[model samples]
Target: MVLSYEPSVKSRIMVCITPQKSSRRLVERGAQRAKETNGEFCVVYVNKNSDISQDLKENEVLLELFDMAQKLGGRVSILVGKKISKTLAEFARENNITEIIVGKSLRSALDVILHGDVVNPLKKEAMKNNIRVEVIE
Candidate 1:
C-alpha cells in the first residue's frame, strides 16, 4: 500500500537480481524476510552495456523476475550503469533501503580479477550508509 521512502521509515528490504538461478531464491528469501518483519520489499536489476540480443534476453529475464517480485508483494526497478556496485549503492541510499539481499557472486575468474566482486563492495558501501547487506546462498 503506502511504501514510505523516508530513511527513518519502517524496514525496507531491497533484493538485487541478476540472470542467475540463485536470484530467484534470493528474491523469495527477501520477500519472506520482509513479511516476517512486517516491512516492504523491492527487486532491482542492474544492466551493463551489451549487444541488442543480450539486452533483449536480459530484459526477458528481468520481466519474469519482476513478476515474481510482484506476486510476493514487492516492486521492481531497473538501473543501467557501467559499475553495478556503485549504482546499487546509490540506489539504496536514495531509496532509504534498510536491508539488501544479494545472491552469491556469479562472476568468472577473469571477471573477478578485472572488476572485482560485487558482494564485498556492496557490503562495505551498505555499511557506510548504515544499511545491512545479506548474502544468500
Candidate 2:
C-alpha cells in the first residue's frame, strides 16, 4: 500500500482578551480553529502599564490566560504600554496575522450606561489595519 499526504501551512492567529466570562470561550474556539488550519495562536493580554498610574497585574486573568495558552499549545504575549488598541493592532500587522478572534463583551448595565454599547474596539482596529477580526459571541 502507498500512502500520500499533503503538508499544511501554519498561519498565525491573534486573540485579544480581558477579564471577562467570555474570554475563555473565545480562546478555546480560537485554538480549535488554529488546529484546523495548522496555525499558531497568540493569546495577548493587554496590560498597558503607563496607562495606569500604578503598575499592577490581574493575577487571576493572567493565570487563566497562561493556562489557556498551555492547553492549546499556543504562544503567550504580554504588551505593557499606553496604547491598548494600537499596540495590539501593531502586533497583528507586524506578524502578518490575518484574523483575530475575540469574545463578545459582557458589560454590566452601569458600564453600558456610562461607556455606551461595548463594541469590541479591536474590531475597528482590525478593519483599519486591514486585518480580519472575529468575535465569538
Q: Estimate each model's TM-score.
A: 0.85, 0.73
Q: Which of the numbered candidates is closest to the native, going by highest TM-score?
A: 1
lDDT of 1 at 115: 72
lDDT of 2: 0.69
lDDT of 1 at 41: 91
Residue pairs of candidate 2 with colliding backbone atoms: none
Q: Ten residues in a row with the worst lDDT in model 1?
A: 1-10
- Per-candidate RMSD vs. true structure? 3.4, 7.7
Q: Please provide, for model 1 over 9-100, each residue's C-alpha lDDT reduced to its tens digit, 9 standing for 90 to 100.
A: 48899999886656789889889988898888999888777444576574676677888999998888777778889989999998888899
In model 2, the worst 10-residue window by lDDT is: 1-10
